[model samples]
Target: MEQMNYSFSVCSSELDYDAYLAFLLENYAHIRLPYPFPVTLSFLASPLLMGEAAFLICNEDNQVIGAFSYIRGTGERQYEDRHIVQIQVACIAEEHRCTRLFLYALQYFTQYLAHGEEQVQEFRFFAPSDDSLRRLFSKISSLTASLETDSGPLDEYRASFSEWQSYASQFRQTALFNS
Candidate 1:
């Protein structure tokens, strides 16, 4: 029998921006993201180009199979809401979605590895009107959902960072063994 390995690292260079875009485009399609590629690119590109606030989950070969990035905020939040974290452009390749890699990536990324040493008080996750995203977001406890829907095109969810910590705990033993 053979074993698989996955590890995470901070996205450190804008030089790899194209590679990240390709990975995101593929995963976006696999997850059936409702938005068009260009539209999503407009948003994700900013964070990717920043070279921080983004992390990649890669295989032993260093191929990025999953990624998650933090929202850079705007106006006041950009300046003062440092403790509040909003994550966007989170995606895992479909083939890896049902595997242990899913839990590993989810747990690690939620820890805000890119900002692991920083203070984080709250976390926000967003799921568009897509089936795959909705299912992924369901891992959180029902009570954690601050808002379900706004009759808009996209769905927004807000929960404390502690809530994410609770959800991520389930895979601790398995993730430990794998990592």
Candidate 2:
């Protein structure tokens, strides 16, 4: 494999906002959102766009190869009031997937949460049913869950953060070796 080079940091105004959105759509074509979501243009230009969340970028040969977004849980924590890190999106160009790009990006994210005082005790991510998200999450120790309803439209499927992570980890490991 070619030498992979990159850096991780909070999304900044200097980056091309449109490219970020395009990157998401291209890498995650399987995701079907409810509507056409806006790109990163707002976040790049607006300070308010930066929330209790973070974005990571992988620059290789002066090109952006991967990006990820993580959010801090807002609700009360069950695990000793510890904050959790939730992954909103994790994308890497297909060409870079075989390398350690995505893995390193994730490592950077976890370290970022290891700051003083407010340490993130957990990490989470969710996946739609079709993907192996559930199985992957289960292996990582995330709690499995689903929508609770007697007879309703939204009562199809769901999984808790912990469950998702547990399963997703399995898939991640598989991907790491298979790649």
Candidate 3:
């Protein structure tokens, strides 16, 4: 199957940040979250004040489509070998989602950290309303990991090279590896 091509850029400017947060609030029901959709500026401003990288995804037409906020944590802060790269907000524009724009932003983020950190061994999505979000994640083969929801298991797919390598070795026994 051919991957749909999309032109996108990652940004962190104030305008992009605000736009990204708005997109999240508009689409929060679809993405699934634990709490009521957050107030945009306050949600982002508090995190920005703490000094973490905020990422925005834009499409070919230069409209902001998605946003993901992540924070790095060392071994066993929560789970085994799973370094916490908390995904605070993640949403793809309703029209451009199938273009895999959110994945593009995630890919850029992984590479962006490669030069410094260990490139994030694993990522966790601990949403309050993950049930609504699992369907979209189920489409990506790499995103198979899940946590238990009231319904069943919520997806928690791999978004890092190391986790991919480990999964490949333990399960597929395929030589394919990242990094």
What TM-score quantifies how close candidate 1 is to the native fold?
0.73
Give the alpha carbon lDDT tens digit for every residue of 3-49 in model 3. 44444344457776677667766776666543333443344444466
How far residue 126's Cα lies from its native spot in candidate 2, in Å, is: 1.2
Q: Lowest summed-lDDT stretch of 10 residues in model 3?
A: 168-177
- Comparing 1 and 2 on TM-score, the stronger one: 1
Residue-by-residue lDDT tens digits, candidate 2, 1-179: 46656766566553544555556656655433222335333322222243544454656555667666655553455334346655556666666664355446544554455443475556655444434555544434444444433322111222344443343344343221111
- For residue 87, give model 3's deviation from the true position in Å: 1.3
In angstroms, give how far residue 97 of model 1 lies from its true place: 1.2
Off by over 4 Å in 3: 1-10, 38-47, 74-83, 117-119, 128-161, 164-179
Model 2 residue 91 lDDT score: 66
Q: Could you give the candidate ranking by lDDT, starting with the highest?
A: 1, 3, 2
- Higher-scoring candidate on TM-score, 1 or 3: 1
Query: Runs in model 1 with CA error above 4 Å?
Result: 49-51, 72-79, 112-117, 130-132, 141-152, 173-179
Of candidate 1, the 10-residue stretch with the lowest lDDT total is 141-150
Winner by lDDT: 1
RMSD of 2: 7.7
Model 1: per-residue Cα lDDT over 1-179, one tens digit each: 35768877767766456566778876665534356667667656767554446767788888888876775444455536767776767777766665477666667766544345667766665565656656766666232443334333576666677777777776653432221
